[model samples]
Structure formats: structure tokens, C-alpha cells
Target: MPKVRVHNVTISLDGFAAGPNQRLDAPFGDGVGWGDDLHSWFMSATKDAAAGRTGTDVEYFVRGDRNIGATIMGRNMFGPQRGAWEDESWQGWWGDNPPYHHDVFVHTHHLRPALEMNGGTTFHFTDEPLETVLRRAFDAADGKDVRIGGGAAVIRQYLRAGLIDELHLAIAPILIGRGERVLDNLGEGIDGYRVSELVSSPNVTHATLVRR
Candidate 1:
């Protein structure tokens, strides 16, 4: 069966997935000491791979993209804009050619037409329930897997609904005093998941959890 999975989700030592005050200029938020070096090991690995480097980080980073046919992310991950999207001119941060080369669903209350970019990526904005959107993603994915490309909150909702089949967390060695946390207030929602694997590199520790 095709699985609903989250991969390469990086969090800080303090459990913050993103910094406080997320906005246009500051994508990960302001006053979080975010820079080229402050990103997760997976981010660094992407750059390193381009420079002909290979390591554990690169290995896991590459694994995240394998067999992912569709993506589901929150509105924040699509952009920093909020409140009904007054302007539809913004085409996301990835420019004309986005990274995702498949159907990318953005979870939002406001409705918007499907956006077809230069690459194979098509952004579908919807306010549908998690299960409904996920079903659409599965249909688009065919027999491949659906990735939970998140901004924390959306992932939490799927977790709460017990929709996720697998999750991969890359814990960075930094601390964001205030921001969104990836694993908080789940209560019994996370009961069905278990840590299936744990590995560490020089910059981060990787943890893989699967439904028990």
C-alpha cells in the first residue's frame, strides 16, 4: 500500500521546528539567528551534494525524495502570506521552477485555482479535510507514496488523525527559544507511532518513526 510519509523534517534542540514571527522577509521567522549555516543537516547536504560531497547527511537527504509522487504542505510552507490571500501574484518562494515535480497540495481555508508552474509541479490550494486531501494526493500519486511536506501544524493534524504511516525527523543541534514545535500536544495521537530507526551525523541526529 502507498504510505503517507514525512521526511527530512528538521527541528531544533529546543523542539522548535521554525522560529517566531514567520513572515515574507523572514521565512523561518525573525530573531531566530537563521542563516546559511543554521539550517538543518538535510539543507546542508543538498548544497554539499551539488559540490560533489557524500556523507550520511547526503544519503538521508537523498532518500527523502525517493518514490514521492505527491506532496501536502500547509499554507505557511507555500508562502508567508496569510488571511485569505489578498494578492494572488505571489507564486511561492521557489520561483517559476519549483523543486517539487509533482502535485503539491497546500492546505488552507481560502480557495484558489490550481497553479501550474514551469516544472512539473502543480500547486493545488484547498480547504478540504485532511482525509479528503490525502485521498486526492493518493490518486495523483498512483502507486507511489505521498509526502507530508509540512510547516509543523499540518503534520500535527495528520498525526492527530492517525493518517501518517511513517515519519522521519532530523534533529538539528541548535535551539530556537520560541517557535512552532513539531511534536507537542499530540497526547494519545502519537500512540500508534514508534521509533523504527535512529542515526546521527556530525550536524544532526536522524530518527525514523513508523506506525506500530
Candidate 2:
């Protein structure tokens, strides 16, 4: 069975995943943004050391090439909200090439055509239900795992639906004070989830939770 995993998702000490006012300029939050907190993780996750030995942290950061077959993310995670893209010109913040080289699905209310960028990455927009998107992602992933690359809201939705099999979080050392909290008003706590692994670096602590 293909597992649904959420990996390398960062959060603040105050439990906020992103800041209150999210724009292109300030995507994460005020002063302390996602960039600052996630710089090490990103560098590690995307770095290919052999070429020049990018960074040591990359060894800790997880990649999709292993068992992951597809990726699913919310519209907010795809790009900064320019208020419903008037055109498909925006490829994303990763420039001409994106990190995700597999099938990537973006959940949105509005529909847009599939975007094929450099490498094997292809972004598909869907206005369907959460379950529908998951099904498509699973199919795209084949028999490998599917990653839910989130923007908090998307991960919350999957969590509430009990669709996530595993979650890997990188707890940063900053405090946002105010922003969009990841675990808010979910009614009851996550029943069958428990921390399975914990690792730490100087900047961030990585924790893994598995569904029982």
C-alpha cells in the first residue's frame, strides 16, 4: 500500500505554520519568516553535496526520490496569493526548475491547466474533493508513498480526515507570536497518532509521528 506521508513540515514555537498576512514578499510571517527558519532544512533537503558538499544538514532532510511517488500541496503552498492568478505565468518560487520532480497536485477552488516545468515536474490543478485529490495522487505515485507537502490548512484537512499515515515535522527555534496555527480547532485530539522518532540538530529538531 502507498503510504501518505508529510515530511519536513516546519512550525514555530508558538505553533503557527505561517504568518497572518501572507503575500508574495512576506510568505511566512513578519520579521521571522519561513525562509529564516527553513533555510538550513531547505539547503539540506535540496543540496547535492558530492558536487561541492552543499551542507551537512542535507543528510538529515528527507527527499522524495526514495519511496515517494507523488506530492500534494494546497494552493498557498504552490505560490504566494496574488489573488487568483490572472495568468499561469507564475511557475512558483523555485524558479525555472522546481524541487518536486514527480507528479505534483495543487488543490484549489479555481481551475488551471497543468504546468510542465524543467525536469520531470508537472503541476496539476484540481478543484475536486480532498479524497479525489488523494486518489489521483496515489495513482500518480504508483505503489510508492505519497507526500502531502502542506501550507498548514491542507495538512489539517488531511489529518482531520484521518488520511495521513505518517508525519515528519521540523520544529524550528523561533517564535512567531501570531500567525496561522497548524493544530487549531480540530475538535478532539488526533486519536491514533504518536511520536515514533526524534532527532535534533543545532537549529531544528526533527520529529516523526506514526498513526496507530
- Candidate number achieving the greatest TM-score relative to the actual structure: 1
Q: What is the C-alpha lDDT of each candidate?
A: 0.89, 0.78
User: Candidate 2, TM-score vs. the true structure?
Assistant: 0.88
Q: List the residue pairs that clash in candidate 1.
A: none
List model 2 lDDT by residue over 1-212, tens digit each: 78999877787767777877777888775664545764456555565544455343455453434698899998888887645778878888787788788899999987889999898899999989989999999999889899998889999888888889988777878777887876776654467688998887777887788888
- Please give, for residues 3-117, the per-residue lDDT of candidate 1 as tens digits: 9999988888788888888998888886554444457466679888889899998988888899999999999999988888787998898999999999999999887899999
Q: What is the lDDT of residue 38 in candidate 1?
A: 50
- Those runs of model 1 whose alpha carbons end farther than 4 Å from true positions after fitting are 33-37
Native-referenced Cα lDDT, model 2:
0.78
Best-fitting candidate, measured by lDDT? 1
